[model samples]
Target chain A: MSEPVVDTTHEEGETRLSTGGLGRTLLVAAGVVFWGWLLLRWANDWLGGLFVPVGQPFVAPATIESLGASIPGLAGAFDALAFAVEYLPALSEGLWLTLVLTVLGIFFGFFIAVPLSVARVYGNLSKYVSLLYTELLRGTPLLAQLFVLYFGLNISGYVPGFLDGVFANNAAWAALVGFILNSAAYQSEYIRSALQSVDTGQLTAGRAIGLSKVDAIRYVVLPQGLRFAIPGWTNELIYLIKYSSLAAFITVPELFKRANDIASSNFRYTAMFTITAVLYLALVITASRMMNYVEDRTAIPGLGTGSGR
Target chain B: MSDNEHTYLLEVDRVSQSYGTEKVLRDISFEMDRGDVTVLVGPSGSGKSTMLRCVNRLTEIDSGNIYLDGERITGPDVDVNELRKEVGMVFQDFNLFAHLTARQNIMLGPRRVLGLDKEEAGKRADEHLEMVGLTPQADSYPGELSGGQQQRVGIARALAMEPKLMLFDEPTSALDPELIGEVLEVMRDLADRGMTMLVVTHEMSFAREVASEMLFLDGGKIVERGPPEQLFDRPEEDRTASFLRRITEMHS
Candidate 1:
């Protein structure tokens, strides 16, 4: 029995060691790639005009040809590498647009969600209205919503003068509006559940201490509910970041759109799409880490975490 | 209006309440003078807690009036929030706001309802924390404190409102056997300080020790009520005597 136990332990140790080594290698590779991208971006800013004309793409055809000549039968790899380097700047610009859309969508969605959730939980007649709004947004596809705002509204001539600039031609703004509405509906569900999970006695206690109904909710219920909703809220934000890719269908020049445009033109789908995926992965990991830090900082001692009492 | 209406700090005159067909309180009448500690004692479902809730307008009475300081509080026109400010309540479960520290919980009423500045509210919270012997645990969250300590904080939170009368609804019922004494001790101290209180409780000894008048309620009516010794020792209604015997036996 002891010998079998020892054998099992040794086998587990070997498995762990191999996995750990693989993880370390991946981490080092990721670090090298990240720093190299930053350095390349910096060099491009300073020496880009000398290397490639301002109006043209930086293809580096001579370097690709020299590498292909030196390493026979690896011409495809060299071509893909040169294509990636040429379009990295465009992808970075697209990444910035994606960040802006996700941040604005989630931030504005939070404001709309709080009131909708409160109405859903507490309002008498307004509850039905809030329910209808959430159901309508959540039931439909975000892409269809974008098309309605971008194409349907323009064709119908229903776009207001101020919003004509946004709906008539601005696909990015239309996509952003769709994202905010969709995100608010989903986020309200998360917040409503959080609000409901708080004990009814909390409101009673609030009232017992001379707080009005609205004050009770504003002070006691919302504070606890919002804290509880943080994890779900963060989940919505992550979803928004990935689904921002759908904006590509509406001609938004976001990360995935840029990747699609470059890939279609150059027929380097594999390289272009893979780089876009990596950039998205980086954004998502950074967002979740920042949210995790927020969750840790705001956690109460005796609540959720079970740290006290 | 009666000539002696102003004599009592709280008056529930023939208040009746029902949830659907089941009547929870039926024509329950009671009065408490300033500085009086009146204890409502009864078996489960006897409407002791409901009676206390009616006094604070937490549960509105179906047919009758409740007056605080001789002003009728049971009407549509009455400002319930302002009434609640004067009527502080402590619950059986010690419902301290879970997210806030004990001090902050006490300060919320003063700062929000009374519109006191933060420094004034903080000072008031400290005084009440010390009053409840919870100054050391002032900064701790409700989850960090034991049940007794939480209930103490609950008492302090209510007292910070400087209410004219405090209602305690089975305040010690949810506490463990050992933890009940500390909460009762705080109640006993409040009575000594001449704070008017209406309490619904099953703790017979505390009721006997602190209650100025003991009201034995049954079937949503006060069957017998007088000084604690009269109800506890002297002859009264058979139901009241029997109920007292059972409660004393259980406690002993």
Candidate 2:
């Protein structure tokens, strides 16, 4: 009854440490804090130079004046946000265009990558076709793809007209084509890695149990592989935020292009760039949180308590 | 039942497997009978698993014919999902779907492949779990079970297929020493109840206790084959004799 485990059901050999166990833990934590403090002390030298008081301190501190008290900067950011809100109808319209472009681009990109990833995995075509597609996509720069679509394809007489005037001109569609193919190049790699990470033994087991190769892939292999790819897929999703900025080059007028237009008109360069940084940061943060939620939900069962193999 | 003995249940004639220039199995041939337990014993990379995988067409044989129930194998033309409905397999790693409960893992094939109604699949899963002595663990995930219990779930999952033939690849080799006996007991019970089985294993006691015929494979070829007593007690080939002695010597 006086054994280490108070509960009879608990395993006897396991022992619990005293509360003071964290004293050494605190010591290690203090060492880390000390190191971080040293690094920050060095960084403050340069950071201090960039930020200086230009107006009255909010609290009128006795020891030192507030350096980050740039009321104009705050007011400018708020004005930028408010200006965006004032242009809500236009920005909302721009928002819709951005969403439409992203959704369409990803959908077409997914379609394109499925065949490409499959070809890469199964070597569906002759060596010439598979190797050609893989090397072409992997070697070419995405910006070059945009340039090719906007300028080269136009000259080469490859114009198609479905989305030619939907976003006010063919430039949007041209951007769509570039973004889709560029994203597909990256996504094909994502899907291929996902598929490869799945155990060959699982496929063999599924087939041995009488599943056809396609059925086995659909039922067993895909489920397992997709689980592993979720984090990587989310990485690609967040990358689309930064990647969407590239659309401005082809005159798609996504967030960055909108901000750029506003910045040029207002002549407040630093303020506009700061506002852009904040918005992009918000987008990436929200996307990351949603992705982490999904990852947490789909985590392997035995792993929740951290004892997973 | 009477016709089971009269015709070979499975026949592999002049089977060959290759990848480009490298041949894996060279014109391998064998026949399996109904209501018989055949043990295929081999060292690693002996093409024993490849032969087992080919029976289910998991590995494509370059040139060969397989006969199941006296019908031509015709690997490409056959409906594999339908074929798998009648032929079950167990793996050394157990390969129990970690996400599903033991009951769900067993029922997955019956639902997806056999087209059994959910209710009927559930009933069958329960019965098969009972068969494998895993009734109490029906709701547990595979990860929650011990290795022997997980292997039993693998057996249950296979049994749910209601297959005519069962193939087991190194089922007990991955299990802990204390756990192997439980899995082998399940296999022995399966054999006693007249399940046609082709097992590849390293457990000598299991082979001796359950097999009606034994094959000793070496270097991708069948080096020796006989009844367990003949193979274990009086092996003709020096390799077979040496292998058996080595296995027994390790056990001692």
Error in Å for residue B218 of model 2: 3.6
Report fnat in order of the candidates. 0.63, 0.36
Expressed as tens digits, the lDDT of each residue in A153-201 for candidate 1 is 7432444567666332367777778888889999999999999989999
Per-residue lDDT of candidate 2, residues A1-309 (tens digit) = 001211123122211112364764664465555445333433433355222222222123322212323454565445444544333333333444565676677778877876676666755554356557667866987677777888787622344565345566466777778768777767777877887877677677666666667777777776666566666777776777677777787777876777778778878667666656655655565566566556556655542211131
**Residue-wise C-alpha lDDT for candidate 2, range B1-252, written one tens digit per residue:** 234555688887888887778777877778888988999987777788888878877677898888777766646788766666777899989887765778988887887777789999999999998988888778877666778888888998898888989999899878888888888899999999999998998888888988999988887678899899999999999999998889877865
TM-score (0 to 1) for chain B of model 1: 0.97
DockQ of 2: 0.34
Q: If scored against the real structure, what TM-score would every candidate get? A: 0.88, 0.75
Candidate 2 — which residues are off by over 4 angstroms?
Answer: A1-100, A126-138, A147-173, A302-309, B1-5, B13-30, B60-65, B74-82, B98-101, B139-141, B219-223, B236-238
Worst 10 residues of 1 chain B by lDDT: B1-10
Candidate 2 CAPRI-style tier: acceptable
